[model samples]
Target: MEAVAKALHPDSKEKRYCNNEIISISKQLLVQVLELPFDSKSRKMTDLLKTFDGLDITKYANLVSQKLKINQDIYYYDNEHKNYYRGLQVMYQQENENDKQESIKTIRDADFEVIPQIDILVVESIWEDNKISHAFAIANKQTLTGLKFCPHCNSKAFDPKDKNYSRDYEIHIIQCENNEGKIVKKVKLDYIQKPFVPHIMQNKTYQYLLSNGRQHEFKPTQYFITYDLETVPKIVNKKFGKSSYQMYELFPLSVASTIRNKQGIKKIFFSQQDGEDFIVQWLNQLFKEAEQVNADNQYITEACTIDDTIPYSMEVPIVGFNSSRFDISLIISQMQ
Candidate 1:
C-alpha cells in the first residue's frame, strides 16, 4: 500500500531504495567527508560534487534526499566578477525559497532581509584560464543601491540653512547586506583609503619609523624585513651562437616573507646564492606560515615548474617567487 511504502521509506517517491540502503549511503558520505583534509568551511555543495568526481549530482541529490530526509537543489555562484561561489546553486525546497519558481530579479530585488540563507562553495577549475586566481574565500553579497555621490563635495558643505544655494554633492557608500541588514550611510571614501595596501589581497606594507630620536611603530602589519641574497637561473633559453658575445649571466634573487605579525612586516630572507634549492627552502617556510590560515593547496604550489616536482606529500604551505604564474601554471598545464 502507499502508506506502507511511505512509512518504510521517508523520502522514497518510487520505493526503489529501502531504508537500510539509505542509511548506509548516509554513513558513507559522512565518513568520506571526515577523511578529507580539505576545509569543510571552504567546501561548497559544488565542491562536494567534485569530491565524487564521476557521480552525477542530480542522481546523488536523489540519494541524499531519501537518505537525509530533505529535498535539495544545487546552484553555483560565480565569484570571479563578484564574491561567493560560482556554478549551480543548491536550494532546499521545503525550507528554502526555491520551492516556488523565482525570477533572478525577485531574488536580486528582495530586501536584503528576506534573502534566504545561502551556502556558497568555492569551486576549482571553472574555466581553462591559468592566470585567473581567486584571492580568498570571500563570502559577501553584491549590491548596487547603497550610495553614490559627487567626489568634489565635502560633508561640511551640506547645511540645512542653504536651501536655495545647494551644492551638487554626492557621497559613495558601502551599500550591501551587513550583519544588521542595513545599508551603510554616506561617508567619505578617502577616509578608508589606506596607502601601501596590497591592492586585491587585503594585505598592506607597513614600517617602523625612527624619527627624532623616538621610535614610532606605524600600522602593526605594515613593516618590512630586509635580507640580501644571490640569484641563479630557474629557467634558461638555449640557442646556438655563431660568435662569442658578452651576456648578463646570474641575477640576484632576494627572498622575502611578508608576515602579518604585530605589524605587517616584510621578512626578507637574505642568501648569498639564489638557486632552486634556496628558493625551495624559503618556500617551505612561507608555506608553513600560510598553513596557519588554511590557504588552498593548489594555489600554494602554483609556481613549481615541470622540472620541479610536487612533493609526494604537502608538508606546509609554500611561498615561492613567481609561484602563482610559473609553478601553478606549469603544473595545471601538465595535468591537462
Candidate 2:
C-alpha cells in the first residue's frame, strides 16, 4: 500500500525511494509475472507472493521479462490513454467525460421557450461590528464569451487542459492547447471580478482558493496534547535597566503556553527565569501521562482498530505550527 501511495508521502532526503509511479509499474509487473503458474479460476487481484527461502531480490522480481531492454520498461503504459488499458490511470478520463455529458439536458417542449433568462447580481454588504449594512439586489447583465489565447502559437482556437482553481485568489488557470490538441501554453481567467461580490459568512473571510471554502476546523482529541505559545519582550524600570544589555533584547523573555485536551484549553505563563521550574514540573507530568497511554494502547478505539492489535491511527502525536523551531527550542533550552 505504501508503494502504491508514495505520491502522497514524498521523501526529500531519499528521492528515489518513494518513486510512486515507478514502484506501481514494478508491482503491477510483478503481479503479472507471479501469476503465470496459477489457474484463472483461482487467481484474483493477484497471486500470493510468499517464499520460505531467503534470497536477494533479482531484476526479474520488478522487471517484466529478461528479453526486453531496461529503458523500454521505464514506463509501463503509453502517455496517451485512449482506451481501457491495464495499470493506466488516465483510462478513467473517458468515463468522467461520459458522466459530464449525461448530466446536461435541454427542455423538450417548445412552449417552455417563453421563460426568459435573467442574471443574479451579487454585492458585498458593509460589515460593521457584525451587522449587515447592505442588502442583495438583482439586475440585468451582459454576457461575454471567454476565449483562451495560446501563448506559444498566439492562436485564439485552443482548448483548456490541466485546469486548477485557487480559492484564495478565486481564479482558474489552464494549459492552453492549440487546434492540434498539443498543450503548450498557460492562460488564466478570473471569475470573481466585476458584477460580483464575495458573500461573507459568519464574519469569516471568503476563501476563493479552496474548492470547499474555509479550512478544516480544529478539534481536540485525547491522543495528542496540542499547544501554542505567546511570547513578549522583557522589560524593567529605566532607572536600573541600562546595565544589562547595550543594544536590544533578542530572546523571548516571557512565554505563555495554552494547552488543549479532552478537559479544555488552559494557559500557563511564566517569566524566562522560571522556565526550568515549569518544564521539570508541568511538562514532565504531561509526558508521563502520554507514555502510559501508549504503553497500554488506551488511545485506540474499537471502530478504528483492526482487531485488538492493529490500529488505523494511533500515536502520541505532538501537533503544532513552527513548533519544531521556535516553541520546541525554547522548551528544550530550559530542559537541557
Candidate 3:
C-alpha cells in the first residue's frame, strides 16, 4: 500500500476538494469512494489503490479513520513521520482475510459455475490511397472453422486464417489496388478518412495544376515568402489588481524575408534603424507581396472551358520555424 501510494504521488498533483458542509465521511460516502455497489467483505488492496489513484491519501486516510473511530496513532509507521500509513495495511489485511473465508464457502456451494471467455474477430480492409475500412465480428471459439479465401487478394488458394481461432484475432486485407490509383498493402496502414479525399483532389489550386499538367513540379508563376524575426528582451512594468511588477518582454529588433518567384529570388530586411515602428512597415510590405502573388497565379476560365471551381480563393502562407512561443507573440503584441 505504501509502494502504491508513492507510485501515485506524481499523478495526484491536482488538489481534491469537498464542500465546506461535508466535514466528515459517512458510511454511504465511504462506499461511494470505494466504488463498491454494496457493503461487502470482498475489498481488495488492488481495488483500494485504484480508488485512491487521484486522491490525497493523507486526507483520505484521516477521513476513513474518523469514520471507523480508529486511533490516528496506529495510522502511521513508528518514527517514519507521515511517510507511511499503517492503518490502511491493517484494514486491507482484515478485509482480505474475510474475503478468503467467503471464497471458501462460495466454492463449496454446488450451484457455483465458472464463466467462459468470449472471442472477437477484427477484420481490416486495406485499400490504396490511404483509406480507412474496418469490420468487427463475434464468433464462438469452439465452433469457428478457418476462413476459406484470402481476405487481402480475394483468392481461395491463399488462406490466411488460423485453424484454431479460439482467441481474439485481427486479420488484414493486403495487396489490393483502391479506386484512388494507389497500391494497397497490409504493411502500409496509413488510414485517411473517405470524405476528405474529394476535397483535396478537387481543390481549385490542385485542379488548376492538374489541368495544365504542372501538378508534379513547382510552376514558374508560383511564389512563396519565408520570413523570420529577431527579438531582444526589454524590461516593462505590469499591473495585476493592485500589484505591479517588472518583467522582461520580447521586442522585435529586425525582420527579414526571402521571396522566390518566376523572376528570381529577392531578399528584404527591415530594422529599428529604418524607423521606430519597422515591424508595421514590414507587415504592410509582406501583405502587398502576398496579394501580388495571389493575383499572378489566379486561374481564369475561357468560354469553352468548364468552371468546376469552388468558391475559394488562394491564400499565401507565412511560415516561421519555432516562432509560435517567441517571435509570433512579439509580432502580436506590437499589432495590438
Instruction: Go through the candidates in order and give the clash count of each.
Output: 40, 6, 1
The TM-score of predicted model 2 comes to 0.23
lDDT of 2 by residue, 266-310 (tens): 556555477636544546665665664454434234575423332
Full-model lDDT, candidate 1: 0.37
Q: Could you tell me which 10 consecutive residues in candidate 1 have the lowest summed lDDT? A: 145-154
Question: What C-alpha lDDT, on a 0 to 100 scale, does residue 24 get in candidate 2?
Answer: 57
Pairs of residues clashing in candidate 2: 166-209, 167-208, 167-209, 167-210, 168-208, 168-209
* Greater-TM-score candidate between 1 and 3: 3
lDDT by residue (tens digit), candidate 1, 98-149: 5443544565777531423322222345456642222121122222211222
Off by over 4 Å in 2: 1-222, 233-276, 292-308, 311-314, 321-325
- Tell me each candidate's TM-score: 0.18, 0.23, 0.35
- Flag regions of model 1 displaced more than 4 Å: 1-252, 262-266, 270-276, 291-323, 327-336
